[model samples]
Target: MMKSFFKVIFLLALTTSTKAQELRFGLQPIQYVSETQGPYVDFFSTLDASTIAFEMDADSIWHARFKVALSFEGKVDVVRFEYTSEDSASSAPLMLQKSTFTFDDTKEIEKRPLEIFLYDEVSNSDWSFSDTLEYVASDFWLSQPVLLDDVEEVPVNYVKRGVSVVPVASLGLPVFENESTLSMYTEGFVASGKYILQYKLTDAYGNIIPGTSGFARCNTGSTPVYNKIDFSSQKSGQYEYSIVMLDSTGQAVAERISPFYWYNDKADEAAWNGPEVSVTRAVFENGWGQWSQVNEYLRMIAPVATMSERRIMTNLKDSEDTARIASFIVNFWTDKNAMDPLGEWKGYLVVVDKVDQEFGSRTVPGYRSQMGRVFLQYGAPSLVEERSFDGRNYPYQVWQYDQLKSSSTPVQQNQVFIFVDQELIGRQYTLIHSSALGEVKDHKWQYHLTRHTNAGPDIDATSTQYSRDNFGERISNSIIIGNQGTWFDRF
Candidate 1:
């Protein structure tokens, strides 16, 4: 019996020694507890991995309540216990109780412990658990705000809003050369607001040339008001210029740059010859068509006179030689094989008469009107597509050219003008299609569309496809002109 008992004891000791051991690590100040009553107990539970618990000395005489408030850098669970002393004054004895605590996701605890003095119910106090707990907490990740101070950079070639320069000198007897005023007029340069203008002139080598004469910059209130910069002294030479505008902020807001050349052939008579002129004088002195005779006379002198002499003599209306001069201009560009000797001259004469009847507003004749100018330049378009828009729909006009030499782009070098009969005063025509003049090369056929009411604030314009190789043959070509609506409807 004694041996069996000893064997049992040895087996029990071996079993105890073979059991698994547990190791624990913990965050300090494991838990804090506060209570309104004496002898309160608090319990803190961390992840099952590792933990350490702490409490005040159990032998202390102070009857402080253990109101427990638990918090953690990570996640944790908690419980509380209350112990009351048994007293003989009452028949029921004080008992110990327990409660579980759960917390929502938050950096701080939603509920805190309250201390109530036993003698006074109205006197309650509260304190943060972090302040009471003397242990250091782990660092947590947080978000912070950032600041930016650099200015945004944009391309120097950035085009400004509502600023564009278009072609203007498409037709007419070169008003640019005849007008006495030294002015620089750009067709499409327009601005609705106040702007300051600055300009620079440069030579062909792209270098600024000083003391070249004929340079002046005139300021108009805004663009499309026809601001003129005099280059009278700059003389007939090629030079590029840039017009820069500034906003109220002193920043460069817009720029208009282009190159132009002025050739003065007065010093070189050999180069001063103008277009060919053929004259046919009437053998009988009959003034039935005296103007015809004058035109022919001018044509005969066109190829022989110097540039200066032509400029002076062409404007001489009261000279004794006026009749002879008129005859020369009359026969200019005549078809020798025509059944009527004056057929070609008669056609052009009709054009001049039409301009006078339709567009003559000021002292200048109808040819000066935007419409008349185009009529003479292109020699009556093969087709005329015209429409009027009240406001809500599209309105346009198409002029078709079957044998344009440049490219297959329609309306490649054409111009469109918009005018309001209501505002039928000076400079009523707003020039469009100014950019089409020199930029396109493959245009053989062209179409022009104006897509808005003649009096509206906004107008949209575009061109059509063109062909070069085919002429007189029916080509699969269509041109659109309008103010608004779909492309097909524009036709």
Candidate 2:
């Protein structure tokens, strides 16, 4: 009798192991209702598998959980459970389930229906299986199954992401979606007087989910701020307005088109044409001398400027002063020449004439611009070529000075100036390049020059002299001058 009992127990264990199977599925928890309404509930009741059993800790309370089980080929698995009342009322449902199973290939069982049974319990209500359900199954080995639960509260948190502004000119007068902001700046509504509108949306846990849909609504008189959409003077047409999604940090994630209102049935059109010219003139005159000259220029030309213009101008100096100094130096050189160094000041005048011819405009004269003045002083280069070797669309100019009669290699310097109404007022200058010529003998400078502007080359370099091919391009057959002993040796 004892031996028989032991054998029966061993066989029962083996049979149980052989009959078990596993199923794999995914679960995504969702919020079905508001926290104040009650705990959200979702049911997964129509499963057809045999030998059903759930994989879960019988004791611990699961914030989110999924159900999984193993069953025999012709049997069904039943998983029945309920959330704790205290936690269910406020918390989200379980997300997935976990379980393990193994099968043996030594024997095969006939295919059969695998059924899953589910039920629920409520106050004063008898526990009963739901009948309005559907089932789907497949032939093959089962893995793990997942069951999802509904979430209660949708928590949200938002932050100010970034701020940007587009110039009114670039957007045109009929701005459609010109001003925008993320949830960080759109949360508040206006109650009276003046207020700010700021809002944000977050998940149940207060984490921001970018690109989610949500809306904010409140009466203007009840909030501290309001969106006084000033379409008062906008054209007579339909407009749109909408609340766009932001990133996890409460920044606007993408551009969106929203809804807007219309102002039809013409009322005095000229009334909304904005302030009169005389009013603007009066304001400008009153604020004119309050700022530094440079600051005033910046305010006048800059796309946007409210204050601080005077402060900036006071700290800046005029650039024409340097240009004047350069002009004086040229005059000094001309006066010192025993004979005409290059010809009468005619050569210099020719350079000035070229500058005027090429760069002179209604607003800016050729000599006033840097490139214009440089051309006037330097004369037409010996060779001029344009190339677009770089991966840029703009063509760069190359200026070659065959033998730039200078005592030393050229030292490059640059200056920038701000002008107002054709008058130079602010200047910034800096030295950018200087070729080193140490105590090494037979030092001579050779240069190939380029520039960033339209008037000059984009790249410049210098190396040993070489021969020219039939096309006059430098060939690789010439000797290096720096390696030679003296000027005579170089020749």
Candidate 3:
């Protein structure tokens, strides 16, 4: 029998903050098998620093203390996290505090109620969280991979199986240009065998990023598998990191998956120094079908083609010159390669295939659909906020991006695209507004979103300026960029 573990409700909401009085944090449980302790679960919790109340003491130093309690079955356990201004140079804490509590069961557990409570004694404020602890019994098992900020051999209380680890307070991880590795720690229990640990990092939309997936050989004896993968070539967005344990025959025995965000604003600006290969005109004509196939390819590139190329493609639509169409296709991809240093046409071909699968309709191809066109042109958004079930607004989605990776125009950062499903079926998400330079722009976007619902006298009802946690509450009120008129002002 084979087993798989997945939690559908496991989602990370970033780019938003909570109200001043409220509290926010991330809680995760990683289960592992120990030789002496049998099976145990390590529950890791990280507190958001924004809501922590820091008071000045008699020495004029700021200090904060949070009382945390865990209740399971009929027993209760507790831990505390304390911080001081001397820890960092900022008024507020520079980093979030994380604490770990272990539950030793020594046996398999199903769905067991686990309640956690956090209280700020100074502010007289309290927050609570509840989650389930699950562990499957198997001869060969792998622990849940914990996303960590750092892992070292230094001895500390946070050290569980072996190495000391600092977990990211939040699930999202921003990848910088200088960052080289995405670190994670896991454990495996084996009866006996040679195995290979395979890892793959893919985007949130389930598309595998090129060169981000690989595996290494391992002989099993001890647990606590500390591994790192090359994160130097990734772009900005939310991604899923998955690991699979393979037997000697290359068959997968166990697997684990975790979600995190990656950011690299300057990844496209890298230098491309390599041997130049000459392009042959006949190369495109021979592999491609005649004029009919060439016409479809021309239409497919409309989302990324330049204005001049688009005008020329329009005139060349009727022409039966197969060689000329192939030339245009080559020139189109070549020009894009010049602008985009790290991206490739082959990788984009994979995205085109994905567009057909996700955005295409029976009547029209996905590339032609407004949602598909935006996706193809701008690439995937960093965070896609979908409020489909809310009765106050149409089933709309907000796709926020750090920057558009591939576009005809030179767009600025923090652009947004809004799409709404009017019919509420058939996946027909029409594009109503965008913050990009050349895409569709509707000044009355809020009016359209709230046409069915009553907006009353309160103007703030239609505004989408809520904190990062509440960013998906309503429509945007202010213009994209005020005086500049268009979002893209400079190259």
Candidate 4:
């Protein structure tokens, strides 16, 4: 039995000013392996080799006698040609018929005169045609997210037209250039099982936009399944797409999600640039406080700035004068840090970068995140308590500040901020409650932490007071809810 396992062929279409042609011969990655098995004792001599073949088809006829044997040492020796033209109307003798072109090495043949020329001696005697060819190796490789060993798989029901689907393998669809399509390869499954392909798109804020979920049944008869996800009709914006897998019995087995960003280059260019800024000589020389631009630094610091300072920034925007913005930054920092103005501003930039790395979101940078705002306003939290998502509730976090400080001015102490990932995906946590005044607050903070529980307020009381029994600590059950009651609320 002749068995072949690995091969990938990509059909590329090229269009010129006058005509369109299809390219079918150049294989992607341009590598093929052919093998032949031998008896158990003949392992050393069992044939395992590779070769390249090309065929020319025109006028509804096919011909294929060209073979280029690839050496085991990764080089080409010669190209054997054995093609004959069947056009009887042309009495032209094939010029390079039955020819063998020897090469010193692969590099020499790829760069030299390998173009074949034939003459139609009967029809056109001296009307000569020329052909030239040159070859160069490609350095392209496919891109995908790095899968770590400890990465957890999230299984999602494949949704299509509000219906559920099951599949064997899933690929998280990614944003593609408008002219391109998303391509992926999947393998490792018990043969003869059925599968399906599903995709869902969500906007920057995690809202499932209407008319986005779609699916298609996949033909899994071949090994190493190849797929293409098209996006010719999707709009330009940031989105999240997921792929879910189901078995032959229509049960979800695995899933993966990835981000997609499509830039809208055709939008109003001027509107995108926004307002420009102007700074003083001292400030400009200090690298405009190390932000990408002076205006960006102004925008980032807005959350932590005082009302009066925010007014100045608002005025600077209306003026559209870079000089005024520059002056405001210098005077603002100088007034805040008269002795070491430059050093103080540079130090703040460090905090901004750290916040961005830790709390940034798809639509908002870290410096603009809810946690980021508090960090810049009150400094680092004195204590941070994190609880991973346990499928009972959303991933929730707690931040406690020993003292609330603004620009080094002490405000309040023993303050706390609570954030919850209500969606359980996307990782963008919302501040649901806090102990600080003027912030969103609710006395029942623990209730929100276990929002998915049926035990309600009493379960919140036991969990908050740490008085729940050993069994209660392990799982959330209806029996625990009835027994625990609200006894701990007295404390």
Candidate 5:
């Protein structure tokens, strides 16, 4: 039995140029083991929008016609999609497409030849990028590490899951010319499991570079990999970055190693280790002001702190050694900005203050609330659409992010979070649904939103958003009256 899941995404500002006879593309294949459905492979592919020639139709609407075919073992499956760009095709950079293949054998490891072909209808150009699915399954699954290069020095500011990848086309990898840091992304799967994740950078001869190795405790289906190393001292050479996952018993269960070539033509680019400042007790004393403030600030950064940092914070919660505390603080932010510890600290402080002022209440500081923690940890949403009580169902708000990035995960674009005010009194918006990976997700979120009104999980979809009689303002378009419910700006 085989199944295919197809998804398409378009971008407005993805502008690029290409010749008429070229169909620039790339493919990234990821494998996973589903608890119920067994094993599956997902193929994520992208095309340079410049390679796509969009034509204005009779109605003045611009459309791009294209088809992708996947073949294996003499069997072929083609997916045809009509992509719409309106008037932004010229500036659009990449068009993302996805397809999934499931295995009926449920084998832990399956190796098969897979061929991908893309045909450009506008230019009559076609290209083939063939790959194989060599999957190995264990108690957990670790995907190939994808290296994303910002050749233009412009951060895309948005990411679709499994979409950031290097191409096999002529664009080629950057010369390490503009980027100060490189981002490597990967995915993992476990049925509610935890593992120790480690990343390392090694030279051509396999020597581990100093300060290029770190580990963190990751827990999730797609566990977030967050590690940083010093890239300043790196000389021009071939390097391999490895991702190792260890079980609870400290045994290496699975590892993905990828080799890459790094030629830093612009090694002279200005390095930013932050403004240098002497580390001393005065640095701690005057920076945080009072001893009480030092302790308070230490307690405040728990949401973004790593497991090791959290442990240190646990031990430092009591000690009165302002100098040691200051040193710890400096070392912590130095990971973010070597010398400018105050830079990261001060910026985070601003976010904390905003969270407190907005989400805090008379009894509970905003940071402790669900909405406030999300704001602090995710750095606020792109928009918050608040829905007040309609006298039938609970009041809920939808928090949407144009792009959401965590200290552990890469940027996730078009992410959404939904919170419900169960009691409908205290304004404590509890998180009920989120599309962000590793976050809580409830498929029956609509049922929960109206469950207080006698709706059950098995209720039909139509009734979940409306009254029992199926009449009243649809949940999709409910407007808050008097224009005074949720008054906070998106900031």
Candidate 6:
């Protein structure tokens, strides 16, 4: 009886293993949703087609059922196939027959979703399976190729180290899906060398995201080799792209790594529509006299100056009496505090110096930057929240002041400034909307910041129903101005 039981157990195990092998089907490489730009004429043409493999056990049923389905823009189409006589051997693997299905266009430019469903009704217990992809319409917008080193405020150039290309500074630019045509111009410094350029998307923690990597090969010719990347399939976010050039023996000779911001339609539109910013060229280009330059520097400080101080600086700019201007500069601080006038002046100088070093960009002075201007004016914020990068929203930083100098006299509480990296690039964050008076105010700031969340109304709406935790709020005309006492307390 024991021997019979053991044999029966072995047979049962064998039967289970055989049943598992009776039917199995896997999809080949399907066209990824992120890679597509416009509507596909033939969806299969974009896919890397491969045969679906099927294996059957010897005792498995010869008759089986198969099904395929496609869905797009809320529409669905399904096809069913039944196998009667066995066209494939039971003991070997067989390639299933392929099917072509047509998808009708909705005449709209939006996310077109596709889904495929397959069922094995006989050997595999008639189990159901599904896969999906999202495509866009012809109205998909593409990004114009932007040289990373040539951004408005942050321009960078590649430095040649031996045979490798290195960015002079860390560079960033907004890349869109429509700009599928990626071309890299490499000066043919190395003849007959093969270069492989690739990009990979990584989260803030630096772990690579799956299915977001691709590579292309370019052979160096007599002239500069313009290598066009096969495709761009990256989704919206920050990513690190690297290129490596190999010698004839396949040894890496040169390489470079650059950071990039990938943005979608709404984010791109917001970036393009940022406030027009112009920094005075006189700061960097003009060769003014020593006192004239000092007067110009004082004018830049007007953003943070008291009303009286601002008037003095403005008058000094037009003053021809150099001695009077010089005396006013000294008395400007001495009158405020007779005890430590020099100390106050020196302290303010230190702040200016720090702001220049920290906030100064290629095109704008430190005090001219959005953050720099606010820092100089309001001192440091009481509550600072920074969301540098997120999968959903554009990079933004929130500055909250429990008490602030809203104007020359009135003090206000619960004041805020929402600086958005509307350009999606790292530099050039602008004051999109603010709560402080005498400052640029836009009620739709919350909508642009949380566009990815879809929690608010359209961009044109003055107010959103949903408020984000850090940066969304409406300012009222009435403000609590109980204290000029605590105003300078934190300052």
Q: Considering every candidate listed, which one attains the maximal lDDT?
A: 3
| TM-score between candidate 1 and the true structure | 0.26
lDDT of 2 by residue, 149-182 (tens): 1124322210111221111111001122323222
Per-candidate Cα RMSD to the true structure, in Å, reads 38.9, 32.1, 12.7, 27.1, 23.3, 25.8
Off by over 4 Å in 3: 1-22, 73-75, 85-109, 151-155, 160-162, 173-177, 180-182, 192-195, 200-222, 228-241, 259-269, 272-491
| Positional deviation of residue 204's Cα in model 1 after best superposition, in angstroms | 22
CA lDDT scores, all candidates in order: 0.30, 0.26, 0.60, 0.42, 0.59, 0.44
Candidate 5 wrong stretches, greater than 4 Å: 1-283, 306-324, 456-491
Full-model lDDT, candidate 3: 0.60
Instruction: Give candidate 2 misplaced runs (Cα > 4 Å).
Output: 1-334, 338-347, 368-370, 388-392, 406-491
Best by TM-score: 3
Pairs with backbone N, CA or C atoms under 3 Å apart (clashes), candidate 5: 14-91, 14-92, 14-93, 15-91, 15-92, 15-93, 360-366
Model 1: per-residue Cα lDDT over 1-491, one tens digit each? 00000000000000011113111111111121111121111221111111111123356421223232344333333333223223221122111212222212232442333221111011122223231211212111000100111114432321112222122221101112322123333211212333444555564345565632232222321122233444343323334555555555656554455444333444223322334343444531342255444543343233223233344444443356654454334332332324554555555567678766765666655655545555554445555544354342234344454432221112223332222232324433422322222221111122222222223332212222122221222233322111112111111
Where does candidate 3 have its weakest 10-residue lDDT segment? 482-491
Candidate 5 residues 145-206, lDDT tens each? 65655444322422434344432221222234333566676655565566888888876445
TM-score of 2: 0.18
TM-score of each: 0.26, 0.18, 0.52, 0.35, 0.41, 0.34
Residue 151 CA displacement from its true place in model 6, Å: 54
Compute the lDDT of residue 72 as modeled in candidate 5.
Answer: 58
lDDT of 4 by residue, 1-491 (tens): 21112222221111112112111111111111111221000000000010112234666442334332322222223333343445321232111111122222234343233222222222121111122223323211111111111113422422212222112111111223343344333322222346654555555445565655655554432223334445444344445555555556777654545454443332212222334334565658556554336677676666555433543555454456666666667666676688886777788888888888888877888876677877777788888877777756567778887877553122566877778888776557877666553355444455567656536445435354554321222222221101111101111
TM-score, cand. 4 vs. native: 0.35
